[model samples]
Target: MMTKYKINCLIVFISILFLHSGQKPCFAQKDGDDIVIGKYSIIHSSILDEDRLLYIHLPRDYEDTQLSYPVLYLLYVDIYNYFADATITTEKLGGTGEIPPVIIIGVANTNRYRDLLPAKIRGRNEGGGADNFLRFFEEELIPHIDKFYRTKNFRMLVGPQAGAVFSLYALITKPELFNAVLSENPFMNPENADFLYPRAEQFFKNKESLKNFLYIKCERNERPQNLEFAEKLSKLLESEKPEGFRFKAEFKEPSGYFIPPIPFGEGLRMLFAEHKLPENFHTNSVKDVISYYEALSEEYAFEVDAPSHMLTFEGDKLSQQGKTKEAIELFEFQLSLYPKSLNALMRLGEIYRRMGELQKARQYYKTFLTIRDTDVAMIHNRLNMVERMISSSAACRIEQEIRKNGIQAGLRKYQMMRSDPNNELYFDESEFNAMGYRLMGAGKTDDAIEIFKLNVKLYPESANVYDSLAEAYMNSGDTENAIINYRKSLELNPDNNNAKEMLKKLKKK
Candidate 1:
């Protein structure tokens, strides 16, 4: 997603997080639980002559995969006021794949005025310490975060209110550091206005292009001074914004602080709007898709693949036209690129099942179930259906054993099939997980718990298995056991917000 930063040059303001709690926070923790979203970390800064607190939120797959991600630096953390908003937004966007997953580093302010507010009027000498803060960002803090955590070169810096002015200042002074600057409602005085055009002239006047994004939005509610500044800055960017320097001003919608946190999501979306696959890019030809993404990679300076949906959409069209073989080819190509892509896996499974290739269909379905990586709720039952045709297969055979005798007898048959060297039966973690859920749905909590326990034993490293066990335990009213399994799930996958919430709820009991 290539979002041009929304730099609202004068509609400046500070925000508080208790905004979401629907009441004033007497203290920080909600419901006696500590911070819900991200954790607290400290970095001692020599340039700022103090220790800085940082709120860091990692993507869900960070611990699971060796993939590096872009960083979103949210300024004025001030104990997670904007930090929570930013993390929540990114998590949703990332989950839906509207935007790629990113590591969010919310730099909490020890002294908000000293660090964020760069310019000072006649009376204020306390401000204007932004230079040292930028140095800390450039020299000390950025390097520290980079060294300790996995981060891509692509970085975004977000600043709200006074912080926005400082972020815009960073754009002019250290444009090389960030790919985008979302300066939200900056306080632009005459000094800032005077400080802008000439500096833009000096820096961007000679360059062929900047290839950076700057988005600004001015607040409204009878602030004539801010409105005046927004107009002047809009004109300045129009004249001086270098080629490829993406810039946009003014909101098409009313942005009154009904917790106008919508702009936060809006600015992010604008910056990376290009990250999404366009309809024109969707074609039946895999070669065309590759070419499009390759060009996009060159533009973003990062490798971007055709989204699974794009490939699947084209594949679906092929299948609808009775070109099953071609659809299979396209889906195979997609699977090779995105090995864990559920769309590709499920499409192939459906195609293979229709062609009477049940073994291949089962294999793809098994893999998809193991991933269970989806935000969409409707597909869960469909994915676990296992067999589309009623056959005397091993899956049905095991179910017969369970009904005739019990879970132990079913396991005996499964083990016999699994242990044979030339076994026709299929055994998989996903298969067991699905069976467990089916048992749970049938009100067989005991059988479900036993089956889930077997899955935990077979795939001990699988966080999803532990999550299943925890849920089964919870359903059986075993709070102590549920808490135990949920803790293990969370330990394995820190991005398990469900496990975290469940643990919090159970602990309060």
Candidate 2:
């Protein structure tokens, strides 16, 4: 809820934060327990000669990935309602993937009159220091954030009432400071109204065009003067809109509600209308997406690289189109940009596995495991399947060599490789048993027998290898060899019930 104080009693904190950016934010500090949604960061401003408190909230995945984000400078953080609403609203907007995720910098107010008011009144607590405050953001706070944090050039400004007034002042005074402005319920006093219009006229006359965004909303129970200002400003902006400047104004009083909304979510959305992808955007090729973001960067006046999820989805589209090479390229490029992004990692692993690049698939899947252990079972299953594929590949190669040269030559080579314990192809009884069963399933009884025999050489002391060899022999109808191996298996482990039963059956046969 907004305070019902008169304009002269206006003690406001301008809190502005939105989503999406990619440049660099300056370094700052953290202390005290006022860390709510974000921590209380202190930026010592030389311009104001005071320690300014900034509450900074970064993207959810900022710590995990290498992607930079846009800056959303929020005012009115001390006003819990505005700060809470903006936080929730921006999250919802970013969730839609329409607008990129932004680093929210909510600046707390020290002096409402000195920072938020542009024109001074007759009282001692009168306004007129808004420029110095803006300088604090431009010279001290913003640079501090940019230097310390990963930020983009597309910054947004937002505030309410006096804070909103300051937002508009920043919009016109320092047109290049922020790319977008969301001003809610800002009413003009006689002094600021006199100053703002003339300042705007001069600025508009001087600058050919300004690429920016403005969304103004006024609710009912607001002063008639506030409604009047909102209407007049809307009409004025309509006629004097600059090239590439976006504008939207909503007067909820006409809708019969004077409720002070926590923050205007729709205002942020309209300002970033193009940030959301179209319905069929995923249907485009990777190059098209790259170009889309490239052009968006150009339009936003910043280097707006496509976010990791965008790249992941685009790469998936490529995979679906039978464009394996393109998918790999896009996913690889995503990894290069984001570095260990789960989306890219998982996509690359799945695609490589599908393409039968077992080693590559294993590489990606293993790396994915290190980043996030949430899907341990699923990832482990993929790794196991990859290992089986690799083992099968080695088995087939050895089989071919046996066919080309001699069984003894292949056996000698296998023995030589097995001497090195670190060989990836080295396996225990379970893998050998699995590999042998795969060959048996393929109706390659001779190959299965040869694989089982290799397993015997690897785990000669283990009963399972001999039991598996016995089954392979029985499958090939070599009753004599089956009986021999089964007897040996039972000798190695007398408690081998399967071996005992198989020996009895073969003896009867």
Candidate 3:
């Protein structure tokens, strides 16, 4: 039997072959329309005293959802379309969830030599502007992109040759700026090598942990000097062996100065190897997996949720194994982390409906409708069936009472109607929150405010209830009440960033 690594390599090889074979040949391509792969934007760089062009490739679902993604900044993009293509394709075909979607930003260069070299050599006139370039990149380019995009704090920088030298410089000087560095065929001449080796030694000498991924690749036969330099650098990094820093070096066959697609793909795979969920992972181990990645997120200073698809897959497996409660918990956790996930809502709706909980099913189905616009016939049929079931259910009558009278009065009536000890009246926090939102959407601000206030009274310990009440008050133009409720919500749940931002905005007003 092949090892898992070999199996994965085979799959990637096949995928690359399939992609290449499926695409139109280079010479046979027709130019009827512009073959646009990404968008172009210009940023005025105050550090460089000039404007720079930024080429950005957003993921396919970027505009459809409010999900934040990691960013990949590629240097020397003018000659590296293959690298961009590989990255994009790998992300698109995220087979085992190893490759998460990323926003690719290719920094087009105006003066490659000047931007890549760290310092001026004896005879080089077009170099020595690397410091200025890095300043422009760190201060102007990155900030502008981050402000305009829904981006995670995670960043990766990829470069080749002299650009790779620049990437190494950044790794030694500003390790916090990027979470990963992919250096391909670094032109580590004596001058560049001497400058960088000292910094690397000093950086590691401090006994500080460097929590990042570094992948360096060089062709053995391309240039003897650069290859030797790459080997020495790799050994030095291994010797220091900073904790939490993952280092990998590959000496490939001669491929000239270009970074071959195979190494590029492998580098990315190595960088995100821990991102994929194991095939044997079950519901019991889900928490452990989440905890592991959560620790990684803390170490890397970014928010990293388990891939939604992997969670859904595991939830389905658990549900198939007659583990309904576990499946429900898994889906609920997924929704808690990614509230905008339509799949999680749909799964919860299906699970509740299968379990004969019509009210909960209807609630989740309705929530799914609010988030997704896809008109699946099966979902429509299930939603219709759920609505019909709810109309004839006893819970419907209690909700009607709540709408007609008030929450307290409705609860009193419900208790009187169901006098048995086991037949208790149940009204969850989410149900009330949903009802309040519906009323708010219908322009009944006063009624919505009442409902939300009642929810807050019923579930005072729930931070979400307070957040809902705060939102309702904010919508009603009651800034004081909104600020107070938002503050209360934030006090209860300090991680409620939405509440904190709303409070800030209301206070500014």
RMSD of 3: 18.5
Tens digit of per-residue lDDT, candidate 3, span 180-210: 9998888776677777778888887775677
Order of quality (TM-score): 2, 3, 1
lDDT of 1 by residue, 261-344 (tens): 525677778877876667565455567667877887788776665555567777888888777778888899888766777778
Between candidates 1 and 3, name the one with more favorable TM-score: 3
| Cα lDDT computed for each candidate against the true fold | 0.73, 0.75, 0.75
Give the TM-score of each candidate: 0.62, 0.69, 0.65
TM-score for candidate 3, residues paired by index = 0.65
**Model 2 C-alpha lDDT per residue in residues 1-509, reported as the tens digit of each score:** 11121111122222322332331322232443232345566777788888877766766667877778888888887664555556556665675666777888888888886789899855565789999898888888888888999888788898877788899999988888998998888857777777777776666656657788888888866877777777878887777777767888887744454536634578766766677667677544567777888898888888876766667777887888877788898999888878878778888898766644567899999999887665367788988888776775555445445557866666776776667676666355665566567567657788778879988987898888999999999999999999999988999999999998898888897
TM-score of model 2 vs. true structure: 0.69
RMSD of 1: 18.6
Model number with the top TM-score = 2
> Lowest-scoring 10 consecutive residues by lDDT in candidate 3?
1-10
**Candidate 1: residue 71 Cα off by (Å):** 1.5
